[model samples]
Target: MRTQVAIIGSGPSGLLLGQLLATVGIETILLDRVSPEYILGRIRAGVLEDGAVRLLDQAGAGARLHAEGLIHDGFSLAFSGQDHRIDLHGLTGGKRVTVYGQTEVTRDLMAGRAQSGALSIYEAEAVTLHDFDRDAPYVTYQKDGQTHRIDCDFIAGCDGFHGVSRKSVPETALRTFEKIYPFGWLGLLAEVAPVSPELIYAHHPRGFALCSMRSMTRSRYYIQCSVDETVDAWSDERFWDELRRRLPAHHAEALRTAPSFEKSIAPLRSFVTEPMRFGRLFLVGDAAHIVPPTGAKGLNLAASDVHYLFEGLREQYRDGSGAGLEAYSAKALARIWKAERFSWWMTSVLHRFPTMGDFDQRMQEAELAYLAQSQAASTALAENYVGLPF
Candidate 1:
């Protein structure tokens, strides 16, 4: 097989890139180690920044999103037994976020790709990249006991953190920075009306709790837990009881309890790999960096990375120029670090640490108090929440 670009992983990032590239007459082949059904089944963050929304529109997959996605102008911060709203749209000069599930986004991208007659190979085994450092790069994978190779001008590593693309880089050339939080988020998805019109981030003596929704009737909630905790230990009743205790009185009163259809615990971490590019191979999304979900920057960050990579590739193909491609790593990282900082800051302020001392707890309270009172502080929070520009 031969193509202009060979994309590893058929997730949103990969599919979005392929769609954008195809619009410009660039041919791409997508390879995935898992089935398409499995990819669509994975649950992930839903918040979309304005930049992400525009990118989806550009990729021709924004129709359903615009139709069904809930627009959030603000979110509440619950602390000191009260809820304080952060006017995201007001503070960010009328910018707002869209609440649309990542699963739905992937589904839309898959459909778009199908309509465009793009080639996607799922259930590919032993996928590998070769000769990325040379003028030509190729990808190899196995299926049905036969090996197949795709020769392409470039390779896109849209695979996630555990993917082979990043690991393919020599350790000596890669510089990594990571911080693993001591706690994890125990999330539950229930088919019940949300407790609030918008999402709420609650800070209580017990821990941090979040009330979020995928739609008017499908709610997603999370409570902070020990890193060592298991989902099996948290029953629906216990989860509901614990969540209620963390919420303010009014919200707690309005909360509706139901059996969760999906329950899981996800650990928090901030990870970034330097120089997202290695010769002809460029890392995008989780392959290059990861942020804690506190600021809801995970998917947004991935979209931004896709934007940068797509722009670079488009410039290279259109004008026969390499400047955009050459600067891809530096430009993407500049925006990435800002998001990491915001996610880290939000996580530190909202979550309770087991090792936090009395002084630390007091400081956390003081920070929240200041944010609640100061318009400048609130604006900063709102700006980050709506997302920084791509």
Candidate 2:
């Protein structure tokens, strides 16, 4: 089989790219190692930046999102027994974020792709890229006890961190930078109303905690835990107690607890791979970068990467110009680094470092105090939270 682009990994990044490319009549075949059910079963962060929301609309997948997703004008930063509202809408001149689960986004995109009559190969085993460095790149994979090959003009490596996309490149050609945090987030999802209407990032003497949601009736909460902590060690009662301790008294009083249906512990890390493009192969989303969820930039970062790469691909097919493709890596990385800095800064300010002394603790407090009183600092946070220009 032959196509204009062969996309590996049918996650949101891959699916979104495929949908957008299809808008311009670009032929793309999506290959994934797992079934669609397994893909949607994986829970993830939900905060959607305005730019990301717009991209979904451009891809014809924003209808359900705009209808069911919660719109938040701002989120609260709770510290020192007080909640400070950032007023995202006011600070960013009326820009806001949408609180929609990543699962829903994927579902909508998948449905849109199906409706468009595009091709998606699920449970494709041993998927491999070939000759991406040469002019005629292709992909091969196993299915139904047979090996198949697909010739393509370009390959998109949206297969994520552990996938073959990044590993396909020679180590000598890649430079990687990573920082693994000392703590992980123990997150819980329960069927209950959220403690606050807007999300809350709380810093307390014990640890860092966040009050978030997937919908008005469904609450998602998290608290910092040791890197070595096990999910099995946390029961519903214990998790609720710890979370209540970390929140302010008023919110604590209003908090509603229920049996959690989903629970997990995810280690925090900041990782980025330089030069997202390799010959005819371009790495998008988790394939190129990862950030701590503190600033809620992970999914949005992936969307922006899609935006840049799609533009390049569109220009390549529409106008027969290679300039946009040539500039993809440099341009994507510029915005990526700024997001990395913000995520790192937010993580640093909120979480308690293992080695933090008295002075370090006071500095964290001082930072929040100044941010609450300073409009400039608040605006900066709001701009990053709502997302920077794509």
Candidate 3:
């Protein structure tokens, strides 16, 4: 098979890139290691930044999102028995975030791609990327116990953290920066109503508790846990008890519990690979970077990468120049670093640091108190929460 671009993942990043490139008469074939239903079964991010929503709409992939996605104008920070609401829409001049899972986004994009009659190879595992230095690069893969080769003008690595794309780059051409947190998130989804109208980030004596949702009938919550905590260590009763201890009980009457549909743990970390490009092979989304989900920046950051990458490609071909690819590293890094800083800051504020001394903890509490009482501090958080411009 031959195409203009070969995208090595069928997740939102790769799917969205194919949709965007198709607008400019560029054809792409997306290869994924898993089936669409399996990919959609993995529960991930739930917040959609304003810019990300706009891009989806522009690509004609936001109809279901706009209809069913919940919009929130603000979120509350609860600490020391106080609730401080940061008006995101007010701070950002009407820009707000939407509550939509990454899984749903994948489903939507896949449907759109199928409707457009685009070429996508599901359940194809990318084996290697060859000849990326030449004008036409080729990617070899195995599907259904058979090997196939795909030739393309360029290659995009949109696979996750464990994929082969990052390793495909020569070690001498790679530079990496990363930080792993001492704690991870124990995420739970139950068939119950949400406890609050908007999301809440609570800091309590026990640990951090987050109140979020997937829909009006389903509640999604998270609590800070040791990075090594196993899911088998907790029962349904213990999970509820921990949630009650850390989460505010103001709406206890409204909160209901049903059998869990999904439960999992995610480690907290920040990662970024420099340059993000090497000749005809480029890395996008989790393949090039990762951030703790505290700031809900993962999916949006990935969308930002694909958008800029495609814009660069268009400029390259349209103007008969290579300047866009040359500048891809600096431009994408600027946004990536800002998001990394924000995610780190939010994670530190909510989670208990194992290495924190008494003085450091006290200072952190003092800062939280100030943020609740001071307008300037709250505005700063509001700005970051609503998202800084890409």
Candidates in order, TM-scores: namely 0.99, 0.99, 0.97
* Residues 308-339, model 1: lDDT tens digits: 88999999999999998999999999999999
For 1-390, candidate 2 gives per-residue lDDT tens digits of 999999999999999999999999999999999999999999999999999999999999999999999999999999999999999999999999999999999999999999999999999999989999999999999999999999999999999999889999989889999999999999999999999999999998899999999999999999999999999999999999999999999999999999999999999999999889999999999999999999999999999999999999999998999999999999999999999999999999999999999999999999999999999999999998899897
* TM-score quality measure for candidate 3: 0.97
Q: How many clashes (backbone N, Cα, C below 3 Å) per candidate?
A: 0, 0, 0
- Which of the predicted structures, 1 or 3, would earn the higher TM-score when compared with the native? 1
- Please report, in order, the local distance difference test score of every candidate based on alpha carbons: 0.95, 0.96, 0.86
Q: Please say which candidate is ahead in lDDT: 1 or 2.
A: 2
Candidate 3 lDDT over 82-157, as tens digits, reads 6788888887778789999888898899988999999888887657899897777999999878899999988999
RMSD of 2: 0.5
Candidate 1: 10-residue stretch with minimal lDDT: 381-390
